[model samples]
Target: MSEFADQYLCAFRQTPAETELHQAAKRYVSEAEAYDRTVCTGPISKDGILPATPRELALVNRNAHALLTRIADAHSHLFSRGELLREISRVDRLGAPA
Candidate 1:
């Protein structure tokens, strides 16, 4: 497994009841890495412009998206309104609203 996949698996290991979520996360990471490799090795035209991505890459992306969505839905409770607002505020470097 790739380092990113291992990291995702480790994150999901926090919840023992989330065995399926862990597997889904691993699959998503694997698929995402495969897509990255495919894009990086894709053929280029004579003019140095990269050609269109293959259909396989699209399918890989869709699979990764589905797996990630399933994992997110299963863990949606972790992202409460307060937590989300805090995260947004942190990213925007602004204090939480009064």
Candidate 2:
């Protein structure tokens, strides 16, 4: 596993009880780590790239995006509107994302 994945495991300490959440978090971290690796490693097209099959990629992207938004919304007090706006701008810069 990647260091980021390991870090997540360490921080989250997943158990068999929350199997679904644990699996979802694992996928999100794994995908994020793959994205980071692809970007940082060299000249590679980050778009149209994914960890598993195209369908899996779509699922990962959809679920991860939804979970991230929920996390941000739930912890809105932890972030300012300006910061959130900047984040949205960053995502926009990435591409025409939803």
Candidate 3:
């Protein structure tokens, strides 16, 4: 189970302009969509830059988890049960958290 994501940052309402999470989510979605549209859907290249190795991928995963954990810790009071449940469901679909 995703213990980290179960308590990851899902909301941020500090000052009147709490858009960090929203912007991060937007950027993530945009980049992912671009990856899908350009990388996955585009022509394949055998000699192009190869995908990240397992070790590299693991490093990235760990870094992301650490960053999210910090954000969640800093903004713990902003999170809600509903948001956390949604995060749990989302992370559960991915097998486990990093």
lDDT of 1 by residue, 1-98 (tens): 99988776654234543343344444444455555555544555432223255765576557656655665676566543343334433533432233
> How would you encode candidate 2's per-residue C-alpha lDDT over 20-88 as one tens digit per residue?
333333444445556545434333354434444555556656665775666446545555434544554
Comparison by lDDT, 1 against 3, better one: 1
Estimate every model's Cα lDDT from 0 to 1.
Answer: 0.48, 0.49, 0.44
Highest-lDDT candidate: 2
In candidate 1, list every pair of residues with a backbone clash.
none
Per-prediction TM-score: 0.33, 0.33, 0.37
- In terms of lDDT, model 1 sits at 0.48
Give the distance in Å from residue 63's predicted Cα in candidate 2 to where it truly belongs. 1.1
Question: Clash number for model 2?
Answer: 0
Pitting candidate 2 against candidate 3, the one with the higher lDDT is 2
- Order the numbered candidates by TM-score, best leading: 3, 2, 1
Report residue 78 deviation for candidate 1 (angstroms): 0.9
Off by over 4 Å in 1: 1-31, 34-53, 80-98
- CA shift of 63, model 3, Å: 0.3
